[model samples]
Target: MIKSYFIQNKSKDLKSFKAMLMWIIIFTFTTILSFSQETPYYQLPKNRKQNHEMIVMPNLDAFTITYFLSASAGIRKPFVQQNGISPSAASFEAPANGFWEIALGQNRNDNWIYEFGITKSNNRLKTSFLELSRTPLVFTNEIEQYYAPFRIKKKILTLDKVSRNAFLNIGLGVSYLIKSNNKPIEEGKITFGQRPIPEPRDYTSLNFRIASSNQPIAFELLTEVRGKVSERLEISVFGKAFFRNNKYLNNQFSFTYVDGSSKEFGNYEKPISILFGLQAKFNSPKYYQYKSRVE
Candidate 1:
């Protein structure tokens, strides 16, 4: 009887072990199948288009240095030394600036641009105008002056509705003004092929004069209307203003006679003025990585 009882217990235990092992295998297979089935968060409607693609730009990209050279020609249109009458008259600006830009970012509207340019920085625009207008000089000559302005600027952008072809950028900047008179031409004579005339340097005209006093600072504002006119070519109109330092820029030339000698006098005066010009921007080709995933 004892041997029969032991045999029955052993058989019962073995059957239970096999049954448990079978259930475990079935459970594992069911769990794996459920996980393997694709389950998206949501499904699109049936009427949607077959292809939906998006383009992404290099929004988070390293900065690059931008090399640019701008040629601008400016004149002192408002100097009164030779206005033909009265003591003086106020003048406006025809300042042309040649700019070289360096940038840390991709030169987008969100980043600032540092500009160092080649300019006439001609402080003697008035004196030069006086000589040209009064000296009766009839010779062909070139007066090359040197000047430079250093500035930091950023762009504010806007969009247009018509054709959606144009964009506007307004810039705000400040600069340090630099002047040079290393070569002051006084009563210089030039000869045309057949005609020779007196182009006096007239440096003696001013009594209280510093050839080129360092006029070092200013605030500026500028705007650009930009658009793509052709393939890979962009054009823009730029307008700017140097609004500060108004008190230091008087065009009035004072004349005084002492001991039977007439003398012209001026201070360290500059012109606070407006500027307008055109700009061309080149757009290089942009490359992007296309990625695809099935939902």
Candidate 2:
């Protein structure tokens, strides 16, 4: 009886092991089918009509250098002018100027772009007007000046394979006035004596002077449309407007036989400029990765 019982127990153990193996195979097959029916996130269709797209991937580090040239035109107010003259009278009316920029920085794939560079600009304007109608009159003056600015800017590019590149840039800068020239003026006063004699005296001379705080801090908003024109070359059209809370001036007046003094004149106001230019980019070989197809 003991031998028969042991044999039946052994048969029962083998049958139970076989049942477990069958269930394991069924579970694995179900899992495989479920996975095959679903699509992967990377295989999704891309929207090619958008200007910018967000990239999601592991973190990467990249470094690049850039150089650019541009031209701009804008309005500016003189920092100091004559006490009695209108601020507009000393205002710069011309807006045809040119500038150049150079930048260098590091990039992290499509995340961010930071750069520091220097810029130089010219300011020239011409207008005709009459001043000091009461005495010492001046007329038809042409003003020309140049400004040099040092600045730093930061930009973020949203990149997508199916769309064009778009980015936002914010910058802070400071500029110094090099030289300012305007039309010359001369005026005199007459005196009456017992013999009816005439006395000559010069009233005031107009000179544009830059102050110690002549350096102005400015800000700008920039937008651009970008695309890769070639394998290692990129082309873009960008626009920007610059502004500053500080003012430029025209002071240092001279009087005949009198002391020369400086007075706070007009404030530089409403200085606005627009730029439209093309930018080309050259890439290094290390910035790209090669992929292979398997049969």
Candidate 3:
């Protein structure tokens, strides 16, 4: 009876030991899984403003240069006969004005840019008188002008896959006429050379220069298509418009012949003009990296 009792007790102890071993294995596995699923104690904040260890840098964006040509729609004028001899109709033609500009630009925000720049421009005019029985008479005028413009541009479209952008800009400008020359053309030969001289006594006088109005205020508008050419360079083609409520850049001119006949040409006003141009913009890599960091 003692031997049988000892066997039963030994079996009970063995089963208890097996059950205890199973419980210990399950507990160890569960503890390991909980530890593996835990997050790190320290993490970085996703918001830039909330990050205390982040550095802030200045954002200086780009420098740009542009060259443009103007297109003017010529207007016709009439001849005034003093000696009872009315000549045939006269017509006025003004060629395109060429302009060059250099500007510095700053990114005002994600979709806007601001630019301030100076432009150099020159205007030329050609006038012809068509008489019934006489050779046509021609007159010419030339002027060099300068202006400063402040503009803000908005991005209308952005194509990141192609690295291209389109923008529209509007701004205000002031123009100054520095030099001018006007002369009559005889037998298709230009009479005088356009050169700098001492300030003429009548430089700003009425009817002496092509423009009667000087230093006029201008409103400017521009549209651009820009593409990235390299890490530091971008290329663009643009169209621009200017609205100046002055006599500047007018196709109109009045001249008197040696035979006492007077003629007036054009519509006597040039309120708006158009220009098309090419631009090259340079960027700094250091500033470009700042764009990536903030984004």
Candidate 4:
């Protein structure tokens, strides 16, 4: 009886040990599979299988410094009138403007990009001849002019990865005009003592105040596609728009005659613009990647 009892105890111990070993094996296999499934976020190539690492590209914590040259043409229609003049009745309408912009900045690992930049635009109104009929006589006049503004812009956005080399961008920013120059205009002529003389003198100043006390802040949405076209060349295209209030442009103007007489002019509404441009990035891909990591 004693021998039988000892044998039964030994058998029970063996069964318990086997069960524990089985459980250990199962747990070890599960842990290995889980770790294998989650590769390092940056280790996978663009064509890798669908996994966490492949779904979200590693955050490149690096600053990307880019400078681009862009030109854009847009129409500006005034919404408000000034100095007893309606926009439709003005000397010119919906003039064309060309702009140049430069930007410098960095991108965070979270896909947020912050940039400060500047843009300059030169615009001109078409020259035209007009005749004013007064009770005493009729006078002929010609309007010719150009206007330009320098603006400082600050921008912030997040890049939503759409593909290996593409992203959808949403941004917001503010623009402030540093300076503006207007075209010169000649008033009508004055005839005194049977002699015709140039009257009011041609004045050279900005026709409208493009910059106001209130800063022009706007939101931007764009889709950017970037890829390496060559060993040192990367290209991207962006479509952008800006929306803002016209109140900031509320301009008050006063024109004074040589005789010390002046006329006060009210404000005119300014139009917004939608712009598109292409950018080329020149640098070593590894440099960019490393810079991104540092950013």
Candidate 5:
């Protein structure tokens, strides 16, 4: 199907077709070279097969750990799935992140990968105080921009043994925000990071309606596929999701107003919030070593 599609558009998409053709040739050549040497390469020694046959995943004759960096584009909604009232300041529409990965395992089959990532947003909601008087004065809302999403991930499913052409991997991760800006909120109560909380870190406050804690940890999951374009380069496609633990990450800023009776807001939090994103990855070989299990 794909071959015919490309063939049909060969004339119309000449440039694109040419580019695609070039990559195909490069990948084919690289695959041949990866295992071709005067003495032969990437072939398992007969003696070592017995020891590795019991393993669930495929093994490589010689392989090394892979390192990568990726850029992510996605969304981060409130911890609560829905709210009777909107957020006081948070209107997170687009979320972005940068991640680093360290992978260990057989290059062609499965591997254990460790990951670290950080996310943040520049969008801020601004509302102002209003007064109905002879002359109306505008009090623009000054909401702070929130960020600092740190995550750790582990890849459980990987199809690297087939990487001479393409590969796939799936992973799970988590994010924690328990330190730095931490506080509770009530309908009419104020939390940390809001005004008077001081400059620099005031943006991390809980001064919004239906707001949760500064540290409502979230769970993350991802799937990625890489296509070899050349011996040293591969292109990737990926999808990821983040689900907040509402049971532990509830809404703390879900409040209205407390004339004077309401002072202290409870410690309880408010619901499930989900965030997701998609990304493209560009990978290149960092280094390669010739190793043999048996001499």
Candidate 6:
């Protein structure tokens, strides 16, 4: 009877241990689920709370480089053509040229844009002269000059009817003659029976001061219409008018021909030039920002 009582107590102890093990498992699972709800690995969109909005900062400073092809036109009298008695002014005409520029720009609250840049242009000037009667001299001269311009432009007017980014600007700049192909008269002179008709270089005065400090200063009026192609690429069409002081010579050159013929052959003034061009501008994507909205 004592043995039987011990067996019954042992069975009761085993049942109690199974019940305790089940309770411990349930408690552990509950604690883990509670912690997971508080701190999750990733948050879902539906679980996000209200009153949290993302903000994007504006791009205040950006850099751009432009490659453009422009055509220039002006009635600039840079040389003189003379026959026997009457002297006339010969105008120089320019063809289309290419320019490369690098600029840094500042955007002010999407209202105004300020730009400063350095540009270089390769230009060709053409003019022809004909003395069809007396000396029978006929010739055409083509001259080349390289210009390096440092400029700053400020926005003056915005055309809201045309586009959001269309604007007019006024520019102040200075340009230096980096190099020129001006040859001496002795190489291309023509002799007519003891009178030597010198080349254009002999009649045109040379500028001894060709440095950057002695560059020509100018003001420009320009209008630009820009279109965005992508986040980093933009295309623009622009028209500019440049009003500059004398770009080359300051005084005229007077030369006496072989038959006691004298004429003034140089003009110290530069005319107003107009330019029309298309440009492509590039910028970095880091200068722009994108925002996400969560409601």
Task: Output the number of the lDDT-best candidate.
Answer: 3
RMSD of each: 15.2, 11.4, 13.0, 11.4, 20.2, 14.5
Query: Quick one: how many clashes does candidate 6 have?
Result: 0
lDDT of 4 by residue, 197-238 (tens): 435532222133333323334444444544445434546565
Report the poorest 10 consecutive residues by lDDT, candidate 1.
49-58
**For this target, which candidate reaches the highest TM-score against the unseen true structure?**
3
CA lDDT of every candidate? 0.43, 0.43, 0.51, 0.43, 0.42, 0.46
> Can you give the lDDT of residue 164 in candidate 6?
43
lDDT of 6 by residue, 1-295 (tens): 9999999999999999999999999999999998898654324323433212111222223232333322233222232222222243334344455555556555443344555555555434443234423443323233355555555556666655443445555555656556566533312333333327654433332111111113445556666666556535667677777665543323233444434555644323244666666666564432323333433
Candidate 3 Cα outliers beyond 4 Å, as residue runs: 1-86, 132-135, 161-211, 249-269, 286-295
**Prediction 4 global C-alpha lDDT:** 0.43
Distance (Å) between predicted and true CA of 17, model 4?
Answer: 35
Q: TM per model?
A: 0.43, 0.43, 0.52, 0.41, 0.42, 0.46
Off by over 4 Å in 2: 1-92, 125-127, 130-213, 249-276, 286-295
- Tens digits of per-residue lDDT, candidate 5, 171-260, equal 776665433332343244334324453444222322333333344466667776755565444455666665544423333233232222
Candidate 4 regions with alpha-carbon error over 4 angstroms: 1-91, 125-163, 178-232, 242-271, 283-295
Worst 10 residues of 6 by lDDT: 204-213
26-104 per-residue lDDT for model 1 (tens digits): 9999998776663221122223222121121223222223334334443332221232232333233323333333212
Q: Determine which window of 10 residues in candidate 4 has minimal summed lDDT.
A: 138-147
